[model samples]
Target chain A: MIAILSGGVGAARFALGMRQIIDPTEISIISNVGDDEVLHGLHISPDIDTVTYTLGNAINPDTGWGLKNETWHAMDALTDYGGITWFRLGDRDLATHLFRTQLLSEGKTLTQVTDRIRKRWKVQPRILPVTDDELRTVLYSVIDGRAQQLTFQEYFVRYAHKPAVSRVIYEHSAEARMTPSVIQALENAEAIVIAPSNPILSIGPILAVPGVSEILSRRRERVVAISPIVAGQAVKGPAAKLMAELGLRQSAYGVAEYYKDIISAIVIDDTDAGLADQIRLLGIKTFPTNTLMTSPETSKNLASAALSMISGEPV
Target chain B: MIAILSGGVGAARFALGMRQIIDPTEISIISNVGDDEVLHGLHISPDIDTVTYTLGNAINPDTGWGLKNETWHAMDALTDYGGITWFRLGDRDLATHLFRTQLLSEGKTLTQVTDRIRKRWKVQPRILPVTDDELRTVLYSVIDGRAQQLTFQEYFVRYAHKPAVSRVIYEHSAEARMTPSVIQALENAEAIVIAPSNPILSIGPILAVPGVSEILSRRRERVVAISPIVAGQAVKGPAAKLMAELGLRQSAYGVAEYYKDIISAIVIDDTDAGLADQIRLLGIKTFPTNTLMTSPETSKNLASAALSMISGEPV
Candidate 1:
């Protein structure tokens, strides 16, 4: 089994690519729950849904999230009642949240609800939330000279990720234990691949889970990470901006440094090949290739290279 | 104030007519809470939304409920997940439920949520729920010689009211108290109008509230009920079937007999004029008219006739 530490859009795109080259049954995605939010009484797991929709081939290519050809009648109608809709939910996409919320209300765990949704979409790859407990990525930022704590969606979506975040804390991570499925996947996998998602907002929360990082560290020889940053910038989202704001280097080198403790190798874009020597100096193998997954072909190639590097094969 | 005891579709149409003939400010609609249901974790007050949409001229003309040109993408998408969708909710109409649920979670009463929605639609006149408490209309039905308890929505929407109901129960009505606004409206109104809705399922739940029936009895001289049953059949819904199933006469006279204790007069269809004498024999004044509200004009005419009867004027 090839387990993937995943987040939203970027990771979903990578999973779409990985499934093309390998039997989808071999993939196990342990998704980040730090970005989970309850809006209008409906539980929304942004990262989980992104992976589900992408793998199901129902994702909107334009937004890289939500359903394709989605209508905004529900969100547009919210304006009629002056309801909070900055975190817009599409009409067709609402069914997923509704199904999830309904099942959760009936006492099903997040992992169970996710599996139900995955099967509904005919997705073969196993998708599990990292932890069933409450694990939220909370960011503290200084706006107008006052410290404000923002939920992941509030920071990334509502605020457009503009606020200079001083700290990113994974709320409830101390008490949040890794789900048995996730632990088993990590323990039994031939290799673990960290998908190129926002490092702080996505992978950071997973690492914060008490036993998750320890497991990764013990199995570091088989772990490989795909850096979201290429040529000193993130391919998408606020990874680049947020990294600089939080005092981390906004480059491929920063990504390698961040995961050096638990990763045997890192995949950086060909454009960032100049940092290969620097990354290798940290005792981590560096595989520089065309990592910008502008198409399915490119994504599949990147996944192949990452897997090859972990198995000590020529990339 | 001219208070109206209300339910869904039929009551909304009557309210629309009342608004046309009188200053909307003079109208106070006390809506039934018996059919208020929570679906997909969203609080859905079917009757309240019907009246609000009708008064705002946004109701679907063909169905008498839901918003006009409403999209069903959300409900259609639910089927993909095998989600329970026997109770279909339109995409645009879902905004009301989402808004109501969010506000209710924030500690607002159903009455407050209804008012917020009313203002959003620019609807005039006060629309108050009979009670903010849990007063569900539960139907005890025998299906294949087995007794089953069904919620109002389950019996009405899910089962299509096919099961023969043995008894109708207003769950928690014994402990439910009428809202102060409803009581005040009844106390201050010059006359009260019971709309042409299902008596057992609609108005029955409102009267089940402890103080509500007492207030109507005290104002019996000024209270009038518009029979939902016309020509020995209901204009819409399962009123006739349920009435007969519950051992009621299932006619205009039966409607009058049902409310005889708390009502002074009733407006029945001209086709049921033969039963007028029998209704009067029961000491309830009867007014015969064309009460089939096929159009807005007909509804307005019916509203005018009912008001004239209360004022002792010729219809």
Candidate 2:
């Protein structure tokens, strides 16, 4: 089985490409639930849904989120009914939320509902949330010199991530217990791949869950990570800004350093060829390739490159 | 103050007409909630929404349900996801459900949420549900001689009410308490006008609520019911078939007999003029006019006619 540590768009795209190249059922995605939040009483799992929709070919390609050809009727009506429409939910997307909310209200755990929804979407990959417990990624922003933590969505969506970040905190990371399926995937995997996702917002919170980093550290030889930063810029999201804010060099080398202790190899973009030797000096093997997945074919190439590296083959 | 017992299209149109002639704030609409159901986990109150949309002039004039110029992207995507899509929830309609579901999850009562929603729509009428409790109207039918109790939507929307209903049961009627506002409206109303809605499925369930009929009975002199049946047939729904199944004449006189104990006046269609004297024999005054409300103006005229009858004036 192939285990993938995912964030959102980038990882989801890579996973989708991997499904095209490999038997979809052979893949198991351990998605970050840290971005989960209750929006208008529905459990909104950004990473999980992104991965599910991307793999199922249901994602809105233009937005890189939500369902394809989505209608904003619900959001329009919601606005008319005095509801907050900043975080827009498409009608079809609302159905997923509605089903999830109902299932959760009926006492089903997040894992159970996720499985049911995935089944309904006919997704082949065994998508598992890192944990069922509440694990919120809180952004501590300094607005006018007053520090306050905001929910991930509030900072990302409501404020458009314009808030100056002082620090980021994962509220339930310390208390969350990893699901047995996730632990088993990590333990039994022949190879582990971390997709080119936002390291701070996406991958950071996933690793913050107590046992996750420890497990990767123990299985370093099987773990490989693809750099999200290509030519000193993030493919998507606030990864670069967040890395610079956290006092780190905004380069592929910075990403290598971040995962050095837990990964056997780092896949950087061919554009950053000079940094390959420097990254190799950290005792992690370096694979240089076109890591910018601008299309489905490129995404598959990236996944294949990472898989080959994990199998002790040069790509 | 005027109180209207409403159902769907015809009732919504009638209510809209009344709003045009009366100070909307002086009118209270006690809508039928028996058609409410949890679809894909979202609580859908169809009758309540129809009334709200019609009064706010947002209802689709073509279908007489949902929002005007609404898209079906959500339903289309839902069908793609292999979800049930027989009960078409337009994109804008989905928004109402999403907002309502969110508010309900946050512990807001249906009444409070409805008020907030109406305020957003800028509707002037006090739209109140018959009760806050669960009151489902189930139609008992036999397919090949096997009995089953189908939900109101299942019978109405899914089957289009083709199967002959052997009986009708107002589930939770015994336990339902009249909404305080509805009871107050009944107690203090200068006039109570029952819209020309399906008498069995619409007004029947409303009166079945424990204290509602009792209140109407006590103030019978102030209550007036417009006949859904005209020329021996119902304007809409299974009222005619249901009446026949229940062993009653499918005529305006049948409606007068159905509501005779709790109503002082019966308004019939001009086509049913011959039944006026026969309906009056049931101890209720009869007013024959063009009760078929085809447009907003007609709805207002019908409302005025009912109001006039209650005031001891010719309509």
Candidate 3:
């Protein structure tokens, strides 16, 4: 079995590429559920849904989130009712939330509902959330010199992540237990690939869960991370800015340092070839290649390169 | 001000007609909520939604319940997830449920959610549910020689009302308090018109509420009921069968008897003119006219005739 540690967009793209080369059923993905939040009485796991939609070929290509050909009628109606419409949930996407909420209300665990939904959508890969427990990423920001914590969605969607970050806390991580599927995937994996996702906001919370980082550390020889940052810029999201805010250099070398003890190797973009030597100096092997996945072909190339590096093959 | 006792299709048609002649804001409709049920954790008030959609011109002209041009993506997805899909909730209708469910979860009363949703749909008429509290219509039926009480939707939609109904009970009528808006409409109305709706399934449950019948009886002079049954047959639904099963004659005279003490006048179809004299003997004036509202013009004509009759004008 091939296991992948995934966040959102970049991770979903890499998984889709990997699915093309192998039997989708042979691949297992441990998705980040740290960004999960209860919004408007609905449980929304942003990363989990992104990976599910991407793998199922149901994602809106233009927006990279939500369902294809989604309607905004519900959101329009919500706005008319004086509801906060900052987090735009398309009508079709709302259906997913409604279904999930119903299942949750009926006492189904998040993992069970996710499995059922993915199976219904015909997604063959076993996409398990890192845990079924609550592990919210709380952002502590200084607004007018008063430190307050906000849910990840409130900081990211409501404020567009514009607030000055003072600290980031992963609430409930100490109590969260890795799900059986997650542990099983790790125990049986032939190779483990970490997708090019936001290191701090996405991957950081995943590693924070007790036993998850320890599991990766014990299996370090088989684990490889594809760097989200190239040179001094992030491929997407606020990864680079977040790295600098958290007192880390905003470069591929910073990414290598972040995963040094947990992963065996780091994949860097060819544009950051100079940093590959520096990344290797951190006691991790480095594979420098064109890692920017601009299209399906580029995504496949990246996935193939990561897999080859894990098998001791030169890409 | 006009107070309309509404059910669903026929009542919606009459309300549509009345809207053309009166300021919609001046109209108050006390809709039957006996049909409401918690389906998949959604509080779906069908009769209220039908009336609201009809008044807003968003109702499906063909199906007569949901919004026009509605997609069934939610229902389709629900079935794909192994959820019960016997009752069809269109995608647009699902939005209504989602908003209402969220509001209810946030501790808002049903009346508050109804007002918010109706206003958003741009429905001007005050569409008040008969009660904010639970008042479900349970249909007791004999299927395969066994008696069982089914929820209104189970009887109406799932079984298609196939089994012979033995008893119809309005559970919670003893506990349900008439909403303030409904009481105000009854007290302030210049004329009260009971739409041509099923006497047992629709109007029966409204009168079953603790103090509603007493209020209507006190205001009998202004209260009028248009017969749902005409010429020993119902225009739609199981009214005829239910009336027969209840050991009442399936005619307009039976409707007059059903509303004997609370109504001052009964409007009977011209086809049922033979029952006019019989109905008049029940201490209620009878007006014979064409009550079948097949078209908007016919509906408008029926509304005018009923209003003129209640106003003591020649019909």
Going through the candidates in the order shown, the clash numbers are 0, 1, 0
Candidate 1 per-residue C-alpha lDDT over B50-125 given as tens digits, one digit per residue, 9 for 90 to 100 = 9999988899988878999999999999988899899889999999999999999999998899999999888998
Q: Which scores higher on TM-score, 1 or 3?
A: 1
Candidate 2 chain A minimal-lDDT segment of 10 residues:
A306-315
Q: What's the TM-score of each model vs. the native?
A: 0.94, 0.85, 0.86
TM-score of chain B of 1: 0.97
Candidate with top DockQ is 1
Clashing pairs in 3: none
Candidate 1 CAPRI level: medium
Candidate 3 lDDT by residue in tens digits, B28-91? 9998999998866678888888888888889999888888987777676666677767888876
lDDT of each: 0.91, 0.86, 0.85
Judged by TM-score, which candidate is best?
1
TM-score of the second chain for every model? 0.97, 0.96, 0.96
In the range A165-230, model 3's lDDT, one tens digit per residue, is: 868888999999889989989877877888899887888888888888898899888889999998
lDDT of 2 by residue, A245-292 (tens): 888789999999989889989899999888988999988898899998
Task: Give Cα distance to truth, residue A243, candidate 1, Å.
Answer: 2.3
* Fnat for each predicted structure, in order: 0.79, 0.63, 0.28
